[model samples]
Target: MESEQALESEAEQGERLGWWHHSHPTFAGITGFFAGMLFVTALPGAFAGLLRLLLDYETAEKLFPFVLLALALPIAMLVKRKTRRFAQFMFVGMVVTALVVLGVASLVLYFMVDA
Candidate 1:
């Protein structure tokens, strides 16, 4: 038993594992979920900000539709076997986050208008 343990440790030391390999089982899910949230929230804001910085308001608004192109990256990830699981979690996170944000925004608007 001790000899086997020693061999296992030696083998582990011989090859370095990548960050993904060394991470916890839930790491991928958590990371993917947060990535999706950021995708929905920050990515658009950052894209819009970049556009506004480089172009006039009219041009920026016109080009806003192009942000949809980013969806292709997640679709590609879903098609790949290795990343499919992460992509699935990311999709769920995106939907949930969007729903929550929209719900809260509507509630705030309703109350503000009523009061």
Candidate 2:
């Protein structure tokens, strides 16, 4: 009975503090923040690149920012369903996305500087 009560109260505390995935609030918030950052930084550029390369579209870059909501909605829904899973997926996704974006950006910079 005592353990059950403690668990109940702990859950209540988490609810009060905006904890997700039944873990502490801070960790969830930090993961979500970085995930959002990755979405903003990489996803649009990725979409633009695909459109340009695969579809042979010249003006797709101008529309990349508009797809921000399209990219974010699925992740938001996944978080709503399961926070821990969201955090795990987002952690990996963010790292990969950031690396790709940075790698391309660096290559572009290198070419510009060399020229």
lDDT of 1 by residue, 19-99 (tens): 455555887798889999999999999999999999999999999999999999888999999888789889988999999
The residue-by-residue lDDT of candidate 2 on 14-115, one tens digit each, is 798765555665665666757756775767768777777865454675655677566557455566656655555565666676787799999999999999
TM-score of 1: 0.82
Best by TM-score: 1
**Candidate 1, which ten residues in sequence have the lowest lDDT sum?**
15-24
Please estimate how well model 2 matches the true structure, expressed as its whole-model Cα lDDT.
Answer: 0.69
Best by lDDT: 1
- Residue 18, candidate 2: alpha-carbon lDDT: 66
Per model, state how many residue pairs clash: 0, 0
The total of clashing pairs for model 2 equals 0
RMSD of each candidate? 4.4, 9.4
- C-alpha lDDT (0 to 100) for residue 22 of candidate 1: 54
